[model samples]
Target: MDNQFPIPGPSVPGEAAPLPTPEEATPPPPSYQAPVSVKPPVVKPSPIKIILPLLAGILVVGLLVYGITKFIGSRLPSESVTTGQTITLTYYGLWEPSSVMKPVIDEFETQNPGIKISYQLQSPQDYQDRIKTALEGQNSPDVIRLHSTWLPLFAKNLFPAPANSVSATEVSTNFYPIVSKMLISGTQVYGVPITMDGLALFMNNSMFQQKSLLPPKTWEDVLSAAKTLKEVDPLTGKLTRAGIALGNTGNVDHWPDIVSLMLLQAGVKLTDIKGAEASATLSYYTDFVTKHRVWDDTLPPSTVAFANEKVAMIIAPLWRAPEIKSINPSLSWQTVAVPQLPDSDIVNWTSFWFEAVGKNSKHPQEAWKFVSFLASAKAQQILFDAATSDREFPQPPANKAVASLAQNNPVVSPFVTSFETAHTFYTASNTRDAKTALNSRLIKYLEDAVNAVSQNQDVVKALVTLNNGFAQVLSQYGLVAAPAAATTP
Candidate 1:
């Protein structure tokens, strides 16, 4: 229904209508122009839309973890092996620090999964005393670092490696000739060495130069040089500046070792205390103090006197160089192989240490395995090279092949030469049984003889006493049979 008034009004008054139209037009301006509805096209959601971000993030993180793990695997070769429960062994060491052992122990653990070595560093001074205590108890370490001189005393407490682990033939073939002499007794291989060491002559180069003397190569040369170099207090009749640190127990360090050198050089078999050669050797060692008066009890320990420039020379080991520097940094010294007997076959004493398994070890098999690794050429070489800092020389290489590697080193040259012809006489006991206990009372007996002679006691009487005491100790220990030596001197 439309209103009719609009058509009449449109013709009648343009002016009036215009006025009305203004309002009317404005009023009906957009007459039935109803808003047209426009709708946008619909978008369908993706299948994982809700979880896509979270899922993608997780996938990226997982890939990152996999990549990192693979990268780590590539870096550690030792971790390649699948492992079971770890076996931890305690190792006691007197000479080497934990820092030095760390590298090899870590590498070994890497190579053999589930094996851990707990190295306990010890002071060399208290090492024997402590180990002796540990051995008597149930809580002792699985492996121990034992000195060669201590072997005779501690051998009964150590576990002998089964022949298959370190056989006699292998010992003879792999190690220096001396190793078999000091360590292998009967069919048992008591220990394996990382490196070997022996007594060497530590000479004061300046003193030798001042006196215009050469390094002694024989007993007679040493005696002549000692006489020339010694300075005596005219009033006290005592040595003010000793020529050599020898001939006595109280004044000389390693007196037993010195006595051993004398006995071996003179061809006095330690097993034969009653022999004429034994008596002669005892007299000779004492004569330096009793007759020559080159060294006396008034001075400090041989090494101390040597360090203080109160003495001209000392017979010590490869380890003595650093000790000298530590005591007196300005001291100038040099080493030569220990002086041999005049015009006799060359011989030297091996005062070394080796790694061994404890007889009471809870993990004998695993402990032996670690010992085997220590004896390996690669390990020995690493040990030798690592030990070079501030030492007289790198630890003397024990492996026959390894020894050849360091043979040309000036400091090691003499030691290597000594290793070629070194001889050790462990007082052979009378025991025939393999596991019988044999004590090392020879060093004690030798010291007593040397001490007696230094006091101007009868050399013949001293020898007799030493022989009787040695026999009684041998009888007490039941060491009647000779130890099986793979190779002989």
Candidate 2:
């Protein structure tokens, strides 16, 4: 049995052991076999296979998260970010103080949780120069308050309103007609005005009552009233009381506006400013001194004259109401719409400020959002109320809806009524512009022409010079997009 059950040899280090003989390898008998425990051999997986699956899962999860984040962020405000930082917009405002704009700013920030407004009231001195410099600079205000006449001067630097924020259609529909003309370019709107103001006739109630005259409805009516109400000292041949403030830029306040209104009413295209209508309009304006003998340079400014009861009537914006009141609180006065052309549709003038977004602003979208809010009907009402509480009265709202509500307000009604048919030109006065500004430069030519006419110069020659001057100024300012018009002198 021992010889038959041969033992196996030791295995070589590098080689497998030889197979055992049948006798040596014989299995134990089934009945007498002792229990044997068996364990399977342990196997290690390939590192590349494990790592590839894990990397693939991680990449899929990362892509899913990134896609979700992008989709969610696209719907939020353009100024908003996932980091949850509030955007601050720098606003350069004129006239309205920080205290006046604070409520509106706060309301806007409340509505748009992602934005806050930093308001600064800019001084009127050199405002045009400063704003132009700011717009050209890298660090520019996000929002700016600009005059409607300055549109041509600043349109290149202004950011057009995004259709999603404020569309041209919305601007035309919601605001006054002049708004569309001033703010809308093609399908884009560049700005929105909070107030609507133009020329209105202010009459001393005592003077009108004594003469039994109603508010002038036509130019004829105005001329007649001027003649009837004027009081001249026969002994000194000096004007003790003036009829109207219509002639001579030296003493007439807002002479440019009055002149522009007359020109527009006479169907003179200010851009061209030629033809018989232009001559007649200028003559009509100057005639109040030279021919009509109603107003002259002998008196104080038109506003002061009206306040002192030295002038029976004056054409001025409603903002002057406070000044006139401050000058003479006990004086009885009434406001009426500016006189219209006889047998013609109503045509009035407008000069007011609007809110614009800077083209170079880092937060243009946010800026436009705040401006759009300020232009809304709700915001207009709020602003009008705020102004009313803050001061004696506010200018008529540019929002047609809000203006309509003030139809019964005596202080605002005349301007509100005029706004419906109002138009604006670049010749607006009191803009507090630089000497080299478009308005100031253009107004110089206007002043020269008016002075010439007042001094009895040939109307046709004066107007020819005026037309050439207008061409030069409009072309220089890039206000006229057309080819330089040929001016005949």
The model with the greatest lDDT is: 2
Q: Give the Cα lDDT of each candidate.
A: 0.70, 0.81
Candidate 1 C-alpha lDDT tens digits along 241-336: 898887777878776666766666665556555455566666677777777778888889888888899988888766666767779999888788
Candidate 2 Cα lDDT to native: 0.81
> What lDDT is obtained when candidate 1 is compared to the true structure?
0.70
> How do all models score by TM-score?
0.74, 0.82
lDDT of 2 by residue, 1-489 (tens): 110111112311110011111121123576896668889789877689899999999999999999999999888887575657889999999988776777778888889988988898999988999999999899989999998878767877888887569888888899877788777656767789988788889999999999898888888889889999999999998889999998788989999989877777776667776766677667777888987788888899999999999999999998899999999999999889888765565678889899999888998888889999998998888887778777775787888888876776787788888887888777788999778877888889999999998888897888888878877777765565435556999
Off by over 4 Å in 1: 1-83, 124-133, 136-138, 149-156, 233-238, 390-392, 405-409, 425-441, 481-489
TM-score of candidate 2 on Cα atoms, chains taken together: 0.82
Clashing residue pairs in candidate 2, if any? none
Question: Candidate 1, residue 181: CA error in Å?
Answer: 2.6
Q: Tell how far residue 244 is off in model 1, in angstroms.
A: 1.2
